[model samples]
Target: MARSVRWVTGAKTQWTIHGEQLVDENRHIRLSTADVELPDGTRFTQYVARMPRCAMTLVFNDQQQVLLMYRHRFIIDQWVWELPGGYVDGVEDIAAAAAREVEEETGWRPRSMEHLATFQPAIGSVDQPQQVYLARGADRTDTAPDVNEAEKLDWFTLPEAATMIERGEIVGAATVVAVYRALTLAP
Candidate 1:
C-alpha cells in the first residue's frame, strides 16, 4: 500500500498549452517554444530549454569536510566552487550517475550514498531536473577527472562551506542547495 499527500497553495492559476515547437534539437539539449494561455486569458508564445536531468554529490569525509571543485566557468567569467556532478548518462540510474560523476571529478568513491533532494535547477526557463546525493566515507581512487574539468579539488568544513555560500563563493544553484541541505538535514 502507498500513501498519498495532497499539497495546497492559497492562490490558483492554470496555464493551457495550445501547441509547442521543437525549435532546436541536439544531442545534449532541445529548445522549444510553447503557445500558452494564462488563467487571465492572456496568450503568448514562450521559449523553453530542455536538457537531460543531472545529479550532484555532496561527499563528506570522516572529518566532516565536504568535497568541492574550483573551476572557471566561461559563461560566468569567474572561478567558482562547485560539487562533483554532471548529466545522467543514457538510461543510467540517478544515484549511479552521481557516483560516476563524483569518481570522475574528484577521484573518490562514496562507501555509502543517500538521496538528499531533487529540483529543477532553472525552474523558470529550463526543464533540467537535478538529483542530489549525500555521499559518506568517500575514499580517494586512482581515477582522474576529465582534462576539461575542475582546476583543483578541496574539502571544507560544514561551517566553512556555509560561509562560502553566504559570501557568494558558491554560485551554482545545485551546489548551493546540496550544501545547504547537507548542513541542515539530519542523517
Candidate 2:
C-alpha cells in the first residue's frame, strides 16, 4: 500500500514520491530510480533518465527535400538515419545549438529558422525535451561532419522520407517526429 505525502504543485496531489535514489550518472545521462504513489495510492517504481535537452532541425533544400544523416548506432548494431542534432550545451542557446548541429553535421547554416515543436520523446522514463526547428533556407558551410559523427548526408523528398519510416529504415525518434511535423506543418 502507498502512503500520502504532501505534493506542492497546482493544488493537485496526484503524485507522491515515496523515495528515490540515483542509480547511475555521467556527463551525458543520469539514471535514477524512484518509488512513486499515485492519487489512488497505487505505487510503482520507475527508472528515469536525466539527460540534457536536445535541439534538432528539419531543413529542406530548394527542391523541398529534407536533409538527413546516416550513422551506425552501436546499440542497435545496425545503421540508422538521423537528423543533425545534439544535446544543448550548458551555456549555449538552444537555437544556436540547433544551427551549430546543422553546420557541423551537414555543412549547412540556416538562413531563417522557425520552431516546429518541442516534445518529450519518452515522458514515461526520460525527460529529454527536444526542440525541433524548421529551417527554410540554408547555405553551404566549409565545416564537415565531426569525426565519428555521420557516415553520410543526403536529402529525400517528404513522401520518400515517410516511406523510409514505414520501411523501418528511419528509426530515430527525433527524425520520425520531425519528419511527421514537417509533412503536416508545412504541407
Query: How many clashes does each candidate structure show, in the order listed?
Result: 0, 0
lDDT, candidate 2, 1-187, per-residue tens:
9999976777766588888899999989999999999988899998989899999998988888888889999988888887899999998998889988899888889887888889998898998999999898789988866767888888999899999999988998889999988888635
Report the lDDT tens digits of candidate 1 across residue range 47-141.
99999999999999998889999999999899999998999998999899999999988889998889999999778779999999999879888
Candidate RMSDs in order: 6.5, 5.4
User: On a 0 to 100 scale, what is the lDDT of residue 71 in model 1?
Assistant: 94
Model 1, runs deviating above 4 Å: 1-12
Global fold similarity of model 2 (TM-score): 0.89
Q: Candidate 2: lDDT over CA atoms?
A: 0.88
Predictions in order: lDDT? 0.90, 0.88
Question: Which residues of candidate 2, in runs, are more than 4 Å off?
Answer: 1-13
* TM-score for candidate 1, residues paired by index: 0.90
